[model samples]
Target: MSQPTIRALILDDYAHNAFREAHIERPQPQAHEVLVRVVASGVNPIDYKIRSGNAPYAMPELPAILGTDMAGVIEAVGADIKHLAVGDEVYGMVGGVRGLPGSLAEYLAVDADLVARKPKNLGFREAAAIPLVFLTAWEGLVDRAHVQAGQKVLVHGGAGGVGHMAVQIARALGAEVFATVSPGKRSIVEGYGATAIDYRDEPVAQYVNQHTGGKGFDVIYDTVGGQSLDDSFAAIRLYGHVASCAAFGTHNLATGSLRSATLSGIFVLLPMLTGVGRKHHAEILGYATRLIEEGKVKPLMHPQRFSLGEARQAHDAVEQGTGIGKVVIDIA
Candidate 1:
């Protein structure tokens, strides 16, 4: 049999521009891998940052494919893979960087450890929107902070991709969730079962005192880092836990230290970048599927659709901050 050719969105170099209709070599599954026919791909800010040469960690080899999250059906399973069989619907953050093939292609040969059964309640596009953001939120809130019921939790940037997911996850976990957003997004943030605080008009200290009676939040999750991370240090109560996925700045930890609060930083790309702890990511996806099926967790997807050929536009949408929710590329 002749090798098959696949249509993929390939990123040739680090620039704001990307090209579509690139023919790439299709890959067969390794013994522990499964071949997936990609149905949808999710776009993130990191995708565009890497495209523009802003993120050093996303250094894909030249002429690479650009994507991170995807949902699809299994076409074939490798000999050693036991959990999945052909025709199983699945989703995961497969690749697009670090020498691995991404989900922008019509097909992907990914390790079984990097994927999970898609939620029975979600379509391919919705499922594609969950893996990366949900996994990042889960690891920070559940795995790192160990958030418990009745605890007062505050999430920065509650209207963003990771922030929205974090708010929902914390609410589902029984925390008294509070989220910071702009005035225009109050209802959107509150709809996720969190009290919305307008970060623009309200000072962090004021909100902290108002909500927690000056005790401060028991848990603070920072999705928007830098200045927000520093504010989290001051807003957390004594012995409180703070988790941040985007902590990028040089700042004094004096506030947190004075309050005796603990801080943890989450970097969700480690597994895909170094190939370590890959199974844990799959396990989290499995949990997310269960949550979605139970109607406890739901992804907020943008209404617009983009074909694989319009990948550049999809990247631009995320970069321009025009997407209300996750920006997805439909690959039929």
Candidate 2:
């Protein structure tokens, strides 16, 4: 085979305004990593935050490539990597933070344990969108809440990125799922096999009374956070569990305390940022792969697709909420 040159978009600085394309030497895999030919990269809100230099916790050195999730085909495997080999298609949240190189390139030297075989049922675009959101949802619903059959589960922002995944995961786990959404998004939540509560048209107490018959949900997931998290406290049953991926503000704990409820905060980037729990992310995605192959989970793709060079536009779509679901870049 001829020598390979990596084509990547590099951001020189926060004020650079755009990613400039450049061809550099291809990277070789390390002891525990694999060389992947990137086919697609998922555009997320954090991508824009880091691109604009807001997410310091999730960005690397200057002129970095900033993509969190990618799906690609393996070109070569490191000597120590045994589970994956050349020609294998895979996906994962590889990097873009903590001095680790990101995935907005023609290739990635991905940690082997951070990646799983891409579900045979999903294309590169759909698979590329699965990592961060899916891991967040899985950590909240399954790991923290211990969601089980016959439980009453409520997912806030049910039509959103993590919200939609939580809804489907709850359904697949045999929980009776209810989702809070705006009137316009009721159909979207309901389409995922959950009952949709119009947060605007109904008050928290009213929905809690009507849906749970004044009892409350066994588990409540707050993907929206802020006031939604307060509502979650009121909506949860005595000794129930609540999980929030967007927990950032100070709030009164009396509501949860009075009910003896427990709240779990989810920050999925801990693994990537610290490198301590990286394998769990890969394991969660492995489960998602099965859920996807079984037709129990699906990606809600954005209407507009992007090219490798239009990453800025893709980031805008995600940040502005102009896209229907996920905005993905076609890298290959």
Candidate 3:
């Protein structure tokens, strides 16, 4: 009997910025996995970073199928998977890091613990856009900071991928949300019920004083690292919490320490790399599904569309920061 092969985009070299069309044998589900027929694949900045061999921490081996987020239909279920069945629509940041295969293919065998049922309100493309960015935001805001009602929350880089999700999640948690953005992109954050602060026009101290009465925010989510993380320490209230996904590089914690603020670093890829917290990823996505179906959260998608054959263009869109919102490639 001949093995059934599925169409896919394979990356043979990390030196190039393109994918090659190829057909590979379809994967079958393991006892804890599910076979998914991929419908859409979300493109993140990390995708390009890994492709160019820049993200060494989570980079896959060469000649890999590289994609992290996916929306799809379950075609087969493993014996241990009870909550999900064949034919269920699901979405998650399943793979594309280290030893796992990614979603840039017609079919994927993903661990059952890494996915949740797709939000009833969103189509495949929209659902695909939600996983990586949403997971990153939720891990920082809900898991680490424990955001609560009436708290003041600030999201740095609110117009970017993880930043936008942080803004919406904070708003949905009943926090008085504020987002820092460029002047022209103010509306992007404002439309999500966040007070937009023009970071370029106003210095960190000025905005902290103006919006927070100089007491500083109760919680700060810093999506942009480097100087932004430093600014977060200066802008956090005494005893407040600050969570950052991009907390790389040397930083002085003197400001935060002076205020007695709590700082947490979020590395969302750790679960995929170490396999220590895969179930938590599914739980977070389950919460996202409920929030999305209730109309409290939704994904912002780019205007331009790309087919599976145009995967290169999708990576380019994310890498160049040309997409107004999340860029996705239709796989099915």
Candidate 4:
């Protein structure tokens, strides 16, 4: 029998207009893999960077599919797979880089350990938006920082893709969460059980003192990196821990050193890029699923929807910063 064909969003070349719908070969699961019939895919900044050939990592070769996060129902399970079976709903940060076909397709063959059962409370699109951002936040705040109840946690860029997840994860772990966002987004941040600080008007030190009563946040999660990360070093309490996912600029660590604080940078792609720690990614997704099912976490979705063919427009919304929440592509 011949294999079925699948519709995928393929990037034919390193051009801004390269993403388009294409008929591609549907993949079959390997021994430790699962074949998923993708219902939705999430768009992130990395997608556009890879599309433009500007990302640090090597592209998957010509005519590559361009997505990392997906939510779908399992269609087939490999011989070695046990935890999941056919028809199980799952989501994960599978493929999209390093020669692997991405989730922007109607089907995906993904390593079983990289995926987790989706929350029964979430639909395909909402679950699709959770994996990447939730994994990033979990690895940094829960795994690395070990955020505890009563610990004061500060998340920069609180309304962002990863930031919103960080805020909720910290709160779920019983931390006193504080997040920084624009004045207009204060209510959104506050709604997540975080004390919102208006970044445009409130200096880091001011909010740090105001919210923490001059003790400073015990854990500072920098989702905005760059100058925000630098500011985090100063805002954190003495001996506090700082974790950044987007540390891109040259900054003096002298402030952190003087305060006796520790800094850790999170790169969620390390597992996908190096093939190490893949199981932990799956575990984190499971944690996120539980949080969602318990109503402790919810995905912040953009009002608009994009089809696989309109992926470029989705990318544009993320780049332009007008997207209110996670941008999703309907892949069914």
Candidate 5:
């Protein structure tokens, strides 16, 4: 008998209008994999970037399924998977990059180490909105910056995907969190339990002085890279740490070096691209699940919803930044 088939959105080319829907054969789980019926998938900047051909480094072969975040119920578990079982709800940054099949499909056979039990408090869409951004923030703040209680943490681009998560993660880690957002987005940062700074209203040093008595933040997280990274270097206290998930452009290290500070770059896709370090991604998601259950962290979701076939619309929403929060695609 033939394997079961499922519907999916496929990108046949690097064009904005390339998403096409069709049915494909379902995948079988490997020894270290789990087969999941994806209920929802998260739309992220990278998804749009790849679709527009702007992210050549992340380019996948044509006719590829393109999505990075997903939450679903496990349909089956591989032989080596001792913890997960059929009917378990799980989520993760399973694929959608390199040659790996992404989550835009109805079903996925993902590495067991990369899949984690979804937070009981969140539905599939909310859980889908998390993994990538949550992992990016946690890796930068918890793993790299070593955030601690009472430390002054400043997150740049606080209203953005990773920035929002960073702000909440820092606050949950017992830090005095502050986020730099536009005046229009002040409420968003404030809603996440962070002190809001209108980035447009003051210079970095001015806010640094007002917020920290000119001592600078003990930790700076720049989710908006480029110039924001430069500002982060200036805003960090002496010997403090700075981390960024979007540190893609050329950077000057003089200010940070002069202050004896450390800067760490977070590329959350490393695990999906390479076979190594996948377990850490799963571990971070587990921690995020706890934060979710504790009500300390929640994925900021946009009000609009899309179906699996509406991949282009979801990508457009993220690219245009027209959505209130994370744009999600319902698959199941």
Candidate 6:
């Protein structure tokens, strides 16, 4: 008898190298893991960064499969996996980081605690897109900022991946959501129930005075870094909370200190990189499933489609910013 093999795209080296297809031995579930027959893979900015060797912190070693988010059906459950079964549909930001295999293969042996039930209202592609960005948004707004009802919440880059999710989640949490977006993408953020501010047209001080009466927002989520993160500090209310997923750069905190505002830096991949907080990712995804079913959240998908072979183009779409919504690769 021979062991079964699965088809996968492997990256031999970094520096903008392309993925090549190969047949590798199929992975079996170890304890506390599950074998998922991945149907769709979601491509995030991190995906491209890892592929190009820019994200050294999360980059896997060479000859590695690389994908971060996926939605699929469970093929086999490992020991002590009581919450999921062999046939359950699931979605999560499971792997593709250092010390873990990715979802670019036909089958993935993923941590059982990192995934949750797929939303009944969403297909595998849509469900795949929800995990990473949704987790990032929820971790910042709910866990870090503790957003409250009737509070004013502003999302920097509200039309982008994490920004859009923050807008929707904040609105669902009963906050008055405002998002800074380009003029053309005003409809995109507005459709998610956020009031869109043209960040280019209106200066921070001007919009702050007009929309908030110079008081600033109660909560601000900055997905756009650099100047946008700096603007967040200047635009936050006294004693407000500012959460940033893109706070990787250096910035002065004098304004925030003067306002007595709390600043939270979010690195969504920390759980995947480290062994801690893996279950919390699943719990957050569980909340996302309920929110989706309740009609309070949904993924905005790009019109373009890519097969597993076209994964390079998918990464290109995200890296080049050519797509209007989440880019996904249909793998099954």
**Model 1: per-residue Cα lDDT at residue 13:** 67
Please tell me which model should have the higher TM-score, number 2 or number 3. Answer: 3
* TM-score on alpha carbons, each prediction: 0.98, 0.97, 0.98, 0.97, 0.98, 0.99
lDDT of 6 at 261: 95
Clash count per candidate: 0, 0, 0, 0, 0, 0
The residue-by-residue lDDT of candidate 3 on 1-332, one tens digit each, is 98899998888888774789999999999999999999999999888898888999998887889999999999999989899999999999999888989999999999998999999899999999999999999999999999999999999999999999999999999999999998988999999999999988899989999999999999999999999999999999999999999998899999999999999999998998999999999999999999999998878889899999999889989888866899999999
Clashing residue pairs in candidate 6 are none
**Model 4 vs. true fold: TM:** 0.97
1-332: candidate 2 lDDT, tens digit per residue: 86678889888888764798999779999999999999999987888888888876777788788899999999989999888889999999989876778889999898898899999999999999989899999999999999999999999999998999999999999999999988888899899999999998899999999999999999999999899999999999999999999897898989998999999999888888888889888899899999999999998889788998888889888889965798889999
Candidate 4 lDDT by residue in tens digits, 9-38: 778888654777777778989999999999
Give one digit per residue, the lDDT tens place, for model 6 in 1-332: 77799999999989657899999999989999999999999999999899888998999978899999999999999998999999999999998989888889999999998999999999999998999999999999999999999999999999899998999999999999999999989999989988889988899999899889999999999999999999999999999999999999999999998999999999999999998999999999999999999999988999899999999999999999977999999999
- Give the runs in model 2 whose Cα sits over 4 Å from its true position: 1-3
Assess candidate 4 and give its lDDT.
0.89
Write the residue-wise lDDT of candidate 1 on 1-332 in tens digits: 87889998777767645664777678899999999999999998888887888889767887877789999999999999888999999999999878787888999999899999999999999999988899889999999999999999999999899999999899989999999998877888899999999888999889988999999999999999988999999999999999999887787999999999989999898899998999999999988998899998888889999998788889899999976989999997
List ranges where model 1 is wrong by over 4 Å. Answer: none
What C-alpha lDDT does candidate 3 achieve relative to the native structure?
Answer: 0.94
Q: Could you tell me the lDDT of residue 208 within candidate 1?
A: 84
Query: Each model's C-alpha lDDT?
Result: 0.90, 0.91, 0.94, 0.89, 0.90, 0.94
**Cα shift from native, residue 58, model 1 (Å):** 2.2
Candidate 1's error at 321, in angstroms?
Answer: 0.5
Candidate 4 clash pair list: none
Worst 10 residues of 1 by lDDT: 12-21
lDDT of 5 by residue, 217-249 (tens): 999999998998999989999999999888899
